[model samples]
Target: MKKLFLSTITIFILIACSSAPTKKDEIKTVKVNAAIGEIEGLIEEDVYLFKGIPFAQPPVGELRWKAPRKLAPVSETIKAFSHKSKCTQPKENEFILDRGVTEGGEDCLYLNIFVPKGNVDISKNNYPIMFWIHGGSNIWGTGNSYDFSKLAESQKVVVITINYRLGPMGWFSSSHLRNTSEGDDRSSNFGHLDIIAALEWVQENGNSFGGDPTNVTIFGESAGGHNVLVLLATKKARGLFHKAISQSGYVSSFSEQFASEESELSSAKVFQDDIRFLTEDQQIADYLRDMPIKEVFQRYKQADESHLYSISPISIRDDIVIPKEGIYKALEDVDPSVVVVAGTNKDELNLWYLRSKYFYQTALNLGRNLKRSEENLKSWIKYRSNIWRFTGAEEPLRRMSKSNQNLYSFRFDWDEEASTILGDYPLFLGAAHGLEIPFISGDYSLVPAYARPLVFPNESKEGREYLSNLMMQYWANIAKYGDPNTFVQDHRWNKFRIQNQNYLRLDSPEYIQMVNDPVDADEMLKTLESDSTLELKERCLIGWIAEMNFVEEMRGDPPFDFCSEYTSIDLLKLRRLTEGRD
Candidate 1:
């Protein structure tokens, strides 16, 4: 009689559970077993957010300047609702700091995950994952700075953003820090290693969060895009990701001094000398490893702005993570099956020129009158953008296609009704380098202070919303399947081929179409040369520097080999002027 009563109670419980409502079941809270512990995340409306989830052991103390280590599993639960401290980076502009944000810290190897409501069944359903890497020239910026809720909810996908080491902390190479006793004692590019570790964590934990680990897509813009290429070329990252999208990605090579070998003036050497001068010569590595965060930050800040670009942050071709011949040279070795979408904006360089206080000062010097300065700046901006698209986008895509890899190219030309602080925004900042980021992520708050008011005004709300939705769909669609055409029913985003040189000209609400034989760089340069008001040599060097993110590529061979007249001094002057120290 007692056994019969227990069986009846069990049956009643099962029946109640089966009959419960399932549609949009209110998920006030959610839980998932991730890397370190069982994470308790919050469910607000239709989105479930898990922020500040640690993926690796803190690279502090002895681990400083070393590869990340696996984080041991814990029995405790983690309340992952708030963002952790960002990785150590320089203080941002005043507008950014006014938000009461502190500078980055060393213990910042966390990631944020966003999952839509209906796709939270790890036991059965499989949702696509988009891993994001933030871009700030690899010097500054954090993954937590972005909000991926809209993109995740609108398209049933799992979105992730991560924080990796930055600046000297990320890419510094030191002879003392190299593992001399090991089989291979190469150092530098710890940031890249951190990214690899993060992806590995995803591979292990993605399924627990209702994501298809096998269908992961890595996408980034600018520096982040560059990293995507690095991962693409990396042998260890071969099976880690299936697809990649590099927005306004530039190809660059690092020097032996920055990566493999030591130089008299390398970042490592300079810091070592400073430490010895302050403390002592013995145990340089120990002293550096144990140095106070304040002192290290001070030394890092003392580095010359010019040297930071020209001498530092170049990844060493250790033949382990990155090859000896740089990414472009190493691309032939990457798996041909990996689908790639690479492209740049119509006016990538305009953002730099418009944002530069130095450029504004130069315009004042040249104009002697406000209107004249603005005109010359506009003309110069257009000239620079054209050359940028040619060398950075069109040429690289054409060259990469020779490797027989599946690739597509695009040029974002949507600069409709963008009038900001500079006045006449359309002509000045049309489809700038980072403009596509806000559109794709549906987070307009990431838009810069100056451009925010003008580009996203109350009147143009409809257009902005339309463009954001469309771009997000394209991006999410690509992440879901190998092709973006599977999502958009109205228009087919043609696969970029060397034969036709086809590309999608992304505009919104009315004008997004495919075109061939875009702008000609040589012709644009000729026009700039004829303009007696403009300084031809400075214009050429400025355009080149702008294309390469203010860093002049001095390794291997000269970038603009066609332009023979510009001297090293001319390039130096351009750099100083751009930095506003001149």
Candidate 2:
């Protein structure tokens, strides 16, 4: 019976594959001339889909740690149906798509395009372009992970997703590497450079796919959102994207000295002095570059002392891509013409608190020791979420709007009909990190199979669909015009200002509405400051994670001062709780 069931499933899959539509009569293959060659893409679900189009030469061999080079132009025609390998990343245990399903390796600098088919001629229609940057703490995730067909077809826009380098390979920096190089090659944030290259590709080739290169809106979630902020402030990224949206993006600062122990843990110092530094700086650079990608990844993983958070793949304020004062001060220098949409989810930290082994063990320890694990965890999640709002959304908007830039802020609070069969879904996950992705994409599969019902429960399908449609329209409208309220007639998304500080509060049942000072910034701060149950050490940990990246400019008014009352042993045990060895 088991064999029969397996045979039946295989046959069903074969039948489904065979019956699926292919480009045949109605625009089977859409041909367009790109930078390198004339590319042929297929039409799927009324949209032209192009996958695995390389924007930069593969960063392999001696080119490993160096900046990405532009691909030379070619006249040859190439098929862009299949996606290329995802960049080398740490293994995921939850959903490992088969090797046959998608290829992944170091040679993975590529972009995918999805354009809705229009009855009008390609040259006649200028659809707004939405460029998506996936977030995985800059260590994992790929462009292929998202399916933009729903977003493209429904919104009648062109959506593009690109993969940049990850982990040490993407952002590794060293004194030796910098001194040995000249020009922009001396810059450390290779991942940011890769994103610039991709955007450059879009500027050159996006119009071929019925996209308006002049009106492109760059948007991303988490690290991707963080990248958007960097691009907004980056002089090199000027004129690349007209509008930006940073979903749950934070302005974490990086240390100035790339290799010194005084600096925060960086990819360049992943080995922590285990690797020898030879006589010649060039020799050291070669040695580090020539090391196997897997070995490099493993070394960085072992040396990861950032506790539960992922902060290694950081953009350094190397006075090149990033300004010396970091992203906040960089915002002051940002072109006032460039607008922004920035916000965070209601329970942003719950995702980390619920899934991280470190947090879980810490909760267990609290349960065993103080019998206050659950409450502490809840308090920590709420405190961290509040901090994220202040740092990631409110503070950034406050600074950016000061420069006379038309900015908008939002707080995603849509959590409805969540399933709790596996655990307390409402309390544990809520509307956490990356939860908004599925809603924006209208792809519930992005959530884990077991968690799909909870993320988009059947009971809340009406409200969920309404919220998704509203988001799609708002985002597409923002891309088309500078304002999200352009097409949204009924809903008025007020502009963020220094005094009013108005923001859109997104909810499921109520859809979206404009309000002022919805998040009590002062009250939230007081809650953290006055909470007696949370020790100073725990408060410090929450603040550090909330800060995301530590830049030199923030050394004066740091989040939390050193709590001399706590001993090293007390912190060591806490560290063990975070490391999951408790």
Candidate 3:
């Protein structure tokens, strides 16, 4: 059955591929001179589709994470054929596509485009563009993991997606350590800078491919969503994207790795843990700085496995790349002109639950105490709720979606009956989190056909078509008019509750219901905050954690002070009072 499904989907895709317009019929693939390089792409259907376009110089050899340099111009007609290399992966424990699917390197800074077929007679294809940033917790995922064929075929819009550096390669920080000696400020957000470089490339060169460089919409799910939000907050990204959409990933609380004190502690811990592997103590910083990236990368590649939330990146210290307090202040001062669309899955932390079950039970049964797991589970809950809150509040003056920023929120409860991936925990983790992925990407075999997200399941062509149409339409519509309502395809997509709200709830299909009244932001957030605080039951066995040397806080970094202040009776600061192996 699986073979049949794969065969069918393969055939379906090949059929689409065969019919795609060739260079003869496709004007977009013209052998034109570009600012960066001379390349040849195909005019597919009515729009030009460019594949394997390099936005920056390959970060190979020593340039890895130094910063993305411009790809030198190729005066010859370069066939921009297959996907560029994928950004370095964050050591995966599971496989998504295939065992062979595991491939990446430093030279992975390439991007792809799928423009809707349109006017061949027109001199320039000025269609509105949507730039997709793939989400993988800034780790293991790719643009190829998704297909934009449906969007291209239906919306007639231009879509572009890119692969960026991941894990330590993408976000390792060196600032705020009180060391300005070697001075590399851009190291932390080099990945983001890569995206900006891509945008600059698009703005200067997208006209040939039928994209309206001035009208770009940036949207992403999970880590991609957070990246989009961050882009919206950046002065560098201003005017590059007119609107933004963030799904499933938002700033609820500071990700532990992004916290100034915490990020430093994490970086220090990785170095300290690996000290024995080093040849000399004094040369450690110089050696790491001067060593070839491929070597240093190998050493830190599997290092994240030793930590709790491995997908998160340690903060780049304060001085060079981005200042320590810049991001928080940026969110607190987001511009009002940027249109915003944000929401979460019916099960936001689905994968976290997966890790919890696998790692938690395995450790507990082995009598190996798991202290961090207890706190992480709670942090996950707060993180989920914060995605909604951050979109609504933070600043009354700078807030854009005061009910009109075209904000749409939905709870994705497609497969409520799906069993928990864990050993014992069931019922509580239902339709829980990330169950929507297969459906979201239109890949259902990964889950039971019965257990798929509603919008993109195979069972419902009508549902898939409706979702594809609605999602693409709303997205395209927002891109076109700062609003997301298709006269023929969608309902009057209403704005979410922006005045201290719980966000609009999508109870079922065929409904874009109005939020009857505002939800007290304070209450929902309180529940979230109260629930996110660490509890004693999870930490009851880890009695020696506080006294352990590894548990010390950074010099200025406050401990989980909010956890100390939590009002939830269920929460217990176990590390605070318990002093022994209780």
Candidate 4:
């Protein structure tokens, strides 16, 4: 039943820091002349850390729902000592641990930089710049949540993480705002524009921090991954980044008309329905621009609760920012020189599956029904996760391979979790969504302290450390040389192509290898239909999930012939009933 709400409720808490590194009482600070101003940073744990450097003027008041504007140069040395406020977002569920700050102010267009503390000759050997984008379904996340010190210090690379507008503040399409806006100001993707502004800042000031701006790599997971795909497709982002890595990203985009007018749940319709007093287009635009930050957020929250939409209509197909042809079509015409890597976890949907009552059941004192639920859980996860991989990773790479041959794919399958008295964490969680983040960041402490023992027990430390180090090496290598196999000797990761579809299977040392198998949505659905292990209800459920997750073109008429008997709403109600939510 929870699967029905997966679109709206599935929040990808991709990156987080358990705690900041302990700082020495004696302050050790470094100064660099950036494009914005003379910036002062501190040296911590063998890395030079600069925090909360504004890349753009705050999108407040009249700037709301408008494109991010570049910050003017400052003469005084900007003290980048602490992170700025996180972008405004709703408080996450209490069950989610270490989700940085839940609520923040609107003045959040800031970025942090982590550089290797060294005296390298910049003219001779500048490190590659790695820009990170965080994920929270594009609605709830703060770049301040991530600490890239380890990645920077160990990899000898410069890493920058930035915060952008979230939810309705970041993306909104309305005729009122559109008519009043001009040029890039007309773009609904303000968050995307913020990223571009940050990149432009890096291009101008990276050299001051011993980073090679010409070798910038943009990488992120989930919604961040989705943005990376958008940058790859959008012509406006050309030359801003040299390489891209999208971890578990899908190329989902909405038409401008759909976002603004066509649907009853469109951003414009929702706003109009809520604020009926404003008659003139100019009056509406002025009122929205002058609206209080808290009021704007309240309206967005109310609309979200009433409509039950998963994410706001983000990444609109605006001809200026995104091509009218859409993300997939634009990707096919991307710059061939820009190298790309796309991948997904082996059990991408297990995180949600374990939480759903349809797959798992928990009692008051007696724990979850693991033994009875194991078979059905595995079956459902296998097919549903494959559908995720197909839509998010495989299909996008297949389409992108048409123009850019320098593409790679991967599947993270590290599931060495401990079996605790409460339940089998390995069987339930496996290599679930966003689990690969710790590996990439080289921060095993990201696993919550309470669940640390169960998720990463002491016995699994050796293999865990090995895989984490390997994944970091792969990511660093890609940033430096646009290939994960450049420095790593463990395995030769091959390029992904339509004819010879190759992808790296990331796991423990023994299980890591290059896989060449390729399967499409139709093949997967056919296999699911023929599997006698799944009952008719199970098949229908899987079909419904596929229909929801898959792109419009990939969705079949009814997904499954048998599913025709049940409407989508009917299945949703059934799921709700099973979960005791209805």
Candidate 5:
């Protein structure tokens, strides 16, 4: 569930001030701080955790859709014990964030923290700090989902989780919102600004909580992972995070026109052009900002459930924040000094293709409502664009995916059918998208089987232990040394290399493989990405060409069944070159 609160005020001192460095905080439950204003905290052994503590003032009323400002200082300590209520949204919204109307208020700009118990000399101790940004397509998810107390207690590091606005509340970008200050082009990405503010708060106050602000690792999954990239490239977020980890996050592929005016105007234009009819054909620009929030969302939802098409803007690259729209530029163009660990799951686009309601509709050939079907497919294909996502920039994207290859190239294959098929008819989830979360967070009970074994009996006991150890090892490795490798790694860590397309296969008992790379992953992707791109069938043709020699028996044979004669062996080699640094 997505949450929206950011700060809480409550006072609880689990580890007495007089105590020197000890193991755990004496108290077992959460402790809200009076200094930071009552934020909630929980004790999982020796660590005290505060969940949903606000770092900035909520963006509502006058603050609605504005860049988040520093949190207002209160004279009294606020209670920070429970999960801050989230904003209003539907249950189906899985951008990974949710704001239940009843859950939170406009004042929800909080962050969560975990402090090790009975520790003194905390500053010089240099305990690594991990700041987690949750992924939910930028519109769903809060920071409280994963409890970081164990990580804090075991590693003796400070771990923090934070909330940023979502949907129109968070990522509605454009050059629309005027800066109360002069000549500010940051109008479009206020939500991103909110994240930056939270980081700033950490830098300033981490020491007070006995954390080393200097050694910070900013990481997240999906949209949160994407934000890490955004922060990586943005001049604003530079140095705020010394290291970064992006899991299952890819570059936002939007045309120049789409990236021009903050993303919201694109939505506005789409609304004016088509969505007006639903609301008696109101002008998109005139009505969107003024209409009741429910009506505005209702009108947009009615027209199309997919937020990308017609109106919703994806990633905006103005001079201020995002210097470039894609991660390719960030890696190739930015300084290598900015260390990163970027990896994708085994089936990167599986969720885009499989989870799409459009695919289900197409598969069943159900003559559902045309508008609804069209809207659903529009959204589906947009993410899973045969050209944009797969063919058009496939090779380049793959190259980008493998750009930081020297770093750990991990593929999380933890399978859970129940969670993936939350509401789907076909319940076969083979290492689906976002499956890495439970593994990384060690949340095995993610599915009905694990959470409630009666319905999902397959949440085996072995699986739980495997997931728990895997997540802890991976996180601890990165948090300890910016490197995702451990001294006791069960499997040997592999780097992205040209000759061997090796990725650390993270399954029960570690294994590795030097199999064939996606031969047409780039060329087909490039072709499909062109303004005048190839059709899906055309892509299949090109894909067939690339895979000509990409057979399992002949792993390195560039001339396998999928590749056409017109395709060159050099292209495959080029792909290898791009995938591997040397």
Candidate 6:
């Protein structure tokens, strides 16, 4: 019976693949003479898509760990029909919602372009350009994961998505390597340099695709959001983009000394330990450059297994890619005309908290006791997510508003999932991290298949569509006019000022409005201490995780040391032992 089932599934998959529309038969081909070369794209449902167009040479072999090199002009026609391989990174766990390809290659420096077929005339050369940066903690993500066709066609703008190097290959920092390199290649932030190179390519080729290079807007979520903030802080990206939006981005950067050789846990020190068995001399730079891609990934895995490096450091302050003063101080000195939008979800951490065995449990007979866990779960998410909002969105926008008056802030609170036998997704996931991606892209299919029905049930389709449309309008308006409120007249999205501290509350039509809600460390600490639902150790654990998410300087000294009695690792161990996972 099992063999029969497997055979039936295989046959079904074959039938499905055979019946699907082929590109040559169904898609209408279109050609454009970009600066790099003549390229062939496809038009499907009034949206022209150019996929897997190389903007930079592949960073492989001798080019590994170096800044991306620009592509030379080509007279030949380039076929851009399908996406290329994503950048090299670790395998993703099966259960995560944001999962992508299991394996990626080093030869992944490509980009995709989407243009509206009728709304924007290609001959006119005046549409706004929106550059998307995918976010997977800067370790795992590809430009191919997102589909911006609907967004492009509906908003009448040009959308570009590019793949960059990931993991250790993208942001490694070593003094040995730096001494041998020159110019921008000496910078430790290679991933950021890849973004800048893509932007330069857009400036050179955007006119051919009807996009206005001067009106470019760079936006991203999570690590991409973090990169957006990094670009704003660095002078290297000054004239590349005119507007920036960082959704759920935090201002955390490692000093050059810390990233290189300040401590045993530094990336450089950990890498040196990995290669010590292979070599012992001063020619480490040459040895690393010649190392095979598989071996480099193997060494990274071995180092991670030993816990020599607790977390990967991105956007290093090398005084080349990033300024020495750091992201916040540098934000105040950015161009005053540069518009900025920064925001966070109402319950950002619930995505992780809902899956944890430490806080939730299940039984065979009765379902998980939602009533018993409601208070504790809500309290933990409230305090920690508040800190995330304050550090990620409020603080950065407040500082930037000092110089740039064209600033906007928002809090996404659209949690209207239908209750199902599987679970209460509205309570568990809420407006969690990365949920806003679908709304912005107008790609509701991006929602995980397993939770799609419950999250976007037919009964709630009207509300979900309304909210998604509003978000897409706001995003496109910002790219076109440097203000989200230009076309969204009914909801006058206020500018973020230090005094008013007002932010748009993005929710269903009935709930969406501009509101004032400011968060501070002192208030968060006070609320944590006053809450009686949690024990002393529980409060400490929650406080520690929240504070540790941001940089050291932004984390003001709390009134009480929550981790004084028991460290966060200790609590994790205890939870595992109690849950019988030990």
Q: Which ten residues in a row have the lowest lDDT in candidate 6?
A: 1-10
Q: Which numbered prediction scores highest in lDDT against the true structure?
A: 4
> lDDT by residue for model 5 over 118-232, one digit each (tens)?
5543333457788888766675556756666666776667888887766655545433343232233245566688789898999877776667777888878777776776776
Superposed by TM-score, candidate 6 places the C-alpha of residue 375 at a distance from the truth, in angstroms, of 0.7
| lDDT of model 2, residue 457 | 73
Candidate 2 residue lDDT tens string, 1-582: 000000110110000101223557454677876557788888776788888889999999878878889898876787787788778776643332111122247799999998888854454557888999888777667777778889999998999999998766677778878888887788888889999999999899888888889988999998888888889878989999988999988776575574333444564456556455477788877888888766776666556544433245377877888987778888876778877899888887655454345544223311211224667767876777777777778878877876756899988888784544344556655667666776787766654454356556798888888888888888887888787887665768888888888788887746577767645644654466557768788766554444332332333222445545665456556644543343
Instruction: Give the distance in Å from residue 352's predicted Cα in candidate 6 to where it truly belongs.
Output: 1.3
* Local accuracy by lDDT, each model: 0.67, 0.70, 0.51, 0.76, 0.51, 0.75
Whole-model lDDT, candidate 6? Answer: 0.75
Residue range 152-233, candidate 6, lDDT tens digits? 9899899999889877788888877787788887888999999999999999999888899999999998788888998998
- Listed in order, each prediction's TM-score against the native is 0.83, 0.85, 0.70, 0.91, 0.68, 0.90
Residue 66 of model 5 has an lDDT of: 61
Q: 1-582 in candidate 3: lDDT tens per residue?
A: 111011111110111112234557524454445676667767555445567778878866456546677777777776765566667663332322221123477778878877666665322567787888877656555665455655655666778888887766676554322243334434466677777888888888777677788888887776677677667556767778877876664432233345323543245554555544655434454544555555455555455434332324533433333434544455545566777776665434433333333224344321222334545654544444333333322222124343234455544444323232322222223334344444433344444343233212345455544554455566677777787765645356566544533433432355434343332434543444345353434222121221121111211211234434433222323322221101
lDDT of 4 by residue, 135-220 (tens): 87787777777767788889999999989887777777887888887899888788888889889989988888889999999998
Clashing pairs counted in every model: 0, 7, 16, 1, 80, 0
Candidate 3 error regions (>4 Å): 1-33, 42-48, 94-103, 121-123, 175-187, 252-265, 272-286, 289-298, 301-311, 314-328, 354-413, 416-459, 486-490, 500-508, 516-582
TM-score of model 2 relative to the true fold? Answer: 0.85
